[model samples]
Target chain A: MTAGTEMSGPRGTLPREVPSASQDSVPLLEAKGLNVWFGRHRRQALRDVSFRLAPGQRLGLIGQSGSGKSVTALAVMGLLPDTARTTGSIRFEGRELLGAPERALAALRGRDIAMVFQEPMTALDPTMRVGRQAAEAVRLHASATSRATRRRVIEAFAEVELPDPERVADAFPHELSGGQRQRVLLATALLNRPRLILCDEPTTALDVTVQAHVLDLLDRSLAASGAACLFISHDLAVVARVCQDIMVVFDGAIVETGPVARLLANPSHPYTRGLIAAARLDEAAPGSRLPTVEDFLRGTGS
Target chain B: MTAVFTVDHVSQVFQPRRSALAVVALDDVSLTVGKAERWGIVGESGSGKTTLLRLLAGLERPTSGAIAFEGAELTPAGRDSQRGFQDRGLRSRVQLVFQDPRSSLDPRMTVGAIVAEPLRGRRRRAGASSLSRPDRAARTAEVLAAVGLSADAARRYPHELSGGQRQRVAIARALAPNPDILLADEPVSALDVSVRAQILNLLTDLVAQMGLTLVLVSHDLGVVRHLCDRVAVLQHGRIVETGPTEQIYARPRQPYTQELLAAVPRLPAVLPPSDERKPPRPLQK
Candidate 1:
């Protein structure tokens, strides 16, 4: 299929370039036949998952809870637990990351590939001031003076559109609201202008209005930095709003993959169809039973 | 229609122990829930939607104004009392289903005991005139079945069940008392997408079958639009908009409501025709 143009939202600005799926341009991050199992019982978490993320491309991995979405992100970050066993290949910037040394992976983590987690409160330190916490990223990635680091932190804070940047910088994690904390996380993620960003349900805990603002900021930031993004979320609408392409995962496997508009208009997989049907509550008739996953899966003879 | 609940200018304020200023959680909120009417309280975090629901559930009395149930004023519970409802009858008539069944369900107790606990409370109050042990067991099984759980499910603990099954247990416990009003707080926010649909369908079916009044609190407008006829949008402890769901969705009067509705992410409006889609296969059962 031909590369689709970037879908625009009310406040969204188009990216610098659309990453063509068929083009032979070198991908920023590529996963091939990735599989993960946990514990002594060998419980499978991910099953032959694979995808390519081109530079400046925003791909959404949409799935329900425990569908191996977060596991995929964690595997890329080299943050999975010790009990788990992983096979297959993960390449970032032409370097194989599957069995790479921890020291090498650590060096690349915050500087080249940053992650923004779902729960900002727990992700941040309660005792550290917000500005100081953000400065840590700059302190580790770059050799800069304390004064310069402080200025950069404030600048990052302002970039994420946090109100009263200096005041927010001084406040602890508890002082800020959920949305504010998430902004702090975003600022930290973008501190080094990473080549790729792995966001796992970053806006799930936020209110709709706050979520929209954060998403808008993320879109603008990614466009400005020209960074590839693997945005993971369970909400289809949220994914469609931010991503150029979407991969629908169910039970640790990709059920369907395509451009957001084409997938939504004509979903081929039963699971994807059920998910779209369930989320499109506006189209559902009031007082009628909503279609569930089982309803769609029953006749498919999977 | 007779009003099941009349919340009259209720305001809840909390004064921090160290702070001189008082935090106003609910600012003179007034609304009426008519009999069998499904009302949704929509809001973002820190918008006081939960505070309003708690006030209606008789869990907390407002610092000012009064709340009436069936035209009778709700008074605070006396000292050493567990519940805030002064009238024991009101306590038995209203039930609450909380978000995150993981925290809501008592993990130590069997599902049967948890569902039957309400019946025992009523029996203790009614002094031997309420349901006997056998009848209570029968009622527990009946409610479990109503929620799509089997009679054998009563023997298992909450940990033994999936997220969806645990929520069903919570629903069974709420319905066992046969309450006239059901208040659910973000019922499906914690569940997976598929499980959320099943629970939503179950709630719709149960509410219709029982003719129960529902007060659903959610941050998702789509869920609210699907389950409720009327909606009350709350922001920072005040009701900004209150009207029919269709009117609120189509033409929001308040700027805040409009912003809230517009912020909700929606799918592209180019779905294929329903008939063009493959027909669902027959149910294996």
Candidate 2:
């Protein structure tokens, strides 16, 4: 086994009686011992994962596809399919969410906690106008009057810096550009001023210039609302920019977790090191072999 | 000493079915690619880089302007039509490797059949190496070997191979005809990060060994920096800047080019050894 890697047990240590958790000021979201299995064969997708997000804190979940990063997000949101089995504790504002009744979870979903997905096109209803979509979040979570909801929706659009807020609200999702659509999704997520937000690769589908703008918008909104964020993505530079702390997940486990600056500077785990190496597009000498995850896995005896 | 491919004042306009506005995909774009020179076309989405590449490949005709391959004008005529051109072989000398291999490579076909597709098209023309059945098999095996794939891979279906291996098959198929110019469109974008390096190294090695001209189109400036000798930045269907790779990276002239460079994420550098390193998180009590 490679040095610095512990394979036979839980990959990460949960905070014991977190000084900053519940009593001191509850973490916006906390997950512990999250295990998920799917299908008849009972293939384990995630294994014993644990993490905590303080209020207004930004935590980046970094991993490749099929690494259980998305599954973690799903599990937290109670959006996992019926066939899949899940166990472990997920707390939102010190409230138990795992195995909560669908009625109970649905009530908290858009009002207290919200999500932004990778592809806004599929997430938004093609038939509905963008304004109605934002207003719906407010309607579902709060008892605002119709006029107030309309005003809130327009305000949300302006907050995201969408040009011509009223026109954007009136337009359908397909009518807007990729960046504009993503802004609408942000508007929906922020409509209720939720305490926490779960973003799953929200900028992956966008172009570089547009991605930069979206990242800026997300940063500004998070600051303005002071909401905790679980930002998940495959890009290291993006995570570095938006998150203060980082957790490297692999094969459904948290292989490494630490402050973003600390982990980036000196990654202890081989997987994290491999990820850092792979993301270094500028460092590789011309025509040189790029160090891959396979190289690191080979060291791990996998 | 002559240029391998030249695109002069190329303009492509797509007339929308319902809308009165005609979308200009490329606007008066001109570029010259020299023999054995590796060129990178950097642009965001809808920047007409792909359209310019399609023009060079003869896949689409420019609405205006002209493209010349090896000093001969490329016509809208299909590859089979001579159309007053002396070099009837110009069409076969240029090959394109697409972005998505799963879609590009016919899934129903075996890897061997897919790699030999280009050579089979050339078999009709009489030459010293007319590619007998055995010659085709030998060429397929040789190209596969050059791409770091085993001869056994020839028998397997596209579904049997991993994404990286499928891309290798695509590259092999592109090389089967022994084309002098190779165009790759975001070859590594769909691939996993680990496998991307291997494919890039393979491309670099192949281009050097075969002395083939390379045109790579990607949104990633880092990949461009590593593979291309020269780069052309595209914005709003126009070439805003074109220069050597080192100069472009060190000192970008255009605002768009500067934005692209700024967007490329940098790997966090290994920190200097110091006492500031905190101890690992303790296991829960």
Candidate 3:
């Protein structure tokens, strides 16, 4: 239990940061009734999902493996493959996204929307120079020549706090540890000065110590840049730490959404409650049987 | 306390010859799995939780540590005793459920056959006739039912079952011979969260109903907290903290343990000032 209570006591009002009552602030991104369907059968992946993210508001997109959190992130970035069927409105800084031309979406991606996948080892080009890759991202979206792009790449490297940016620029993906590789990816994302950064399990592959550091960097990055973010993760604790508000997605829909503390403390939905109840550590007594496996996780409860 | 398995100052060091990089995976870690204790080994990735489990399962001999089973050293079993202790009778004593259920179960065999594999040795020991074809089928069906799957579901292949169902089949296979100890390594980490509780509950029930010693290895503190009685925190191949789950949670002495507990989502909302924050930042390898 927390030694000191937060701003909202018994009523559990969201800490002053939530901005639950205000909408005047220009949101960097908004998902309004976004719906996604896939396959020849048109299997629905998201149903009427909605959220508003102000500039620099770090939010968590949490759910089990199949919760559609990844799908949602892909859709927001306009990077979904040709096979995926998409519906719904996604506006970026008041710019309409749905039905936008491919060229327009392409221009916005590396510049306005950037993403870091779960596995940096797989996502990165094994043979490509780390600096060269970062430069390529800058060159693609920025109106700059190769020399200027190289300088921007080094600047981006410094922004992510990588040591010896020049040296890292020459190194390949395999030459760095898992956390360093992730930092490279973050640098790549930062190169475009993106407004909305989407991170999909950025630290899942790293050690706890490394995860903590990477997450701290991510947190500071959000604060420093005032960049709105959609952080997708299976680790709810990590999610709770970074995100002011959380959307509990299960299957293809949002099962619950509220301030992180309230949802974890007093979940209204059974699925949300089960996740919290099941998340308990040391609930089992010595020499006694534990509660029935919640099974909420076994099947599609969300 | 009578522990089914005991690790006495065990440590493993992997050295690449001609190089100074001697990777130490375990550091004289010692812990006792008291009989019937649902013990949890919790740590983040590379904290050596899985390596510790591998050591306890006797898959690899520790570089410098003594492991005793029923007061007998396990590292140096005689040839005949090694075969008997490791092969046929292991299911009746200890069994393991892997992290990925789909990959763990062989695709060629049906679920029923998978569950029956462990029963063969157990049947041979209890009575020669006990494992006849029909009897084998009956016992397989019984174990499947105990794990909450119908016998009819056993005829399906691994691909045919969902992730949760596949895990149940894996559990059924592990429990078929009724092992006194079950070591589940991230058994549900790969599954959906909604279904994680059900699998955890099933394991809890099995431990009580069968009087089994469960050594659960997982990075998810939530699952471990819900399932285990005693929790052990491991770091850099060392057992940093060991105590009753409540005591460990209520007051963690080690910095690693405290960091882990702080990372937990269920912790009451306590956003300390930046000065008080000791949360680990990512390390430089």
Best by lDDT: 1
Q: What are the per-residue Cα lDDT tens digits for candidate 3 across A1-302?
A: 46455442534212233433545454668889998888888888888888877666677888777779999898887777777777778878777687777777777787888998888999899989988888878877657988888888888778777889889899999878788889999989877778789999888666556677788788777766766779998766677767766788877889887767677767776666666655543454533433322434454433
Ranking according to lDDT, highest score first: 1, 2, 3
TM-score for candidate 1, residues paired by index: 0.89
Runs of candidate 3 with Cα error greater than 4 angstroms are A1-27, A127-135, A143-180, A203-210, A234-236, A255-257, A261-268, A279-302, B1-3, B17-20, B77-84, B107-109, B120-130, B220-223, B267-285
1 or 3, which is superior by TM-score?
Answer: 1
lDDT of 1 by residue, B1-285 (tens): 558899999899999999999999999899999999999999888899999899888787788888878786775334322343523556667889998899999999999999999888742333335788999999999999999999999999999998899999999999997888999999988777678889999999999999999999998787888899999999999998999998898899998888888887777788534333121221111
State the displacement of the C-alpha of residue A271, model 1, in Å, after optimal TM-score superposition.
0.6
Residues B24-116 of candidate 3: C-alpha lDDT, one tens digit per residue:
988998988888888999987767888888877777778887787766676763344455455445536778999989789999999999999
Complex DockQ, candidate 3: 0.16
Let me know the TM-score candidate 2 reaches against the reference structure: 0.86
Summarize candidate 1's per-residue lDDT along A1-302 as a digit string, tens digits: 23433343223221234445644466778899999999999999999998888777788999888899999999999999999999999988667888877777777888899999999999999999989999998888678999999999999999999999999999999999999999999999999999899999999878788999999899888877877889999888788777777899999998898877789888899888888887777777776788887788885422
* TM-score of each prediction: 0.89, 0.86, 0.79
Ranking by DockQ: 2, 1, 3
Using Cα atoms, each model's DockQ against the true complex is 0.35, 0.35, 0.16
Model 2 interface CAPRI class: acceptable
lDDT of 2 at A260: 78
RMSD of each: 8.8, 8.3, 10.3
Clashes in each model (backbone N, CA, C under 3 Å)?
0, 0, 20
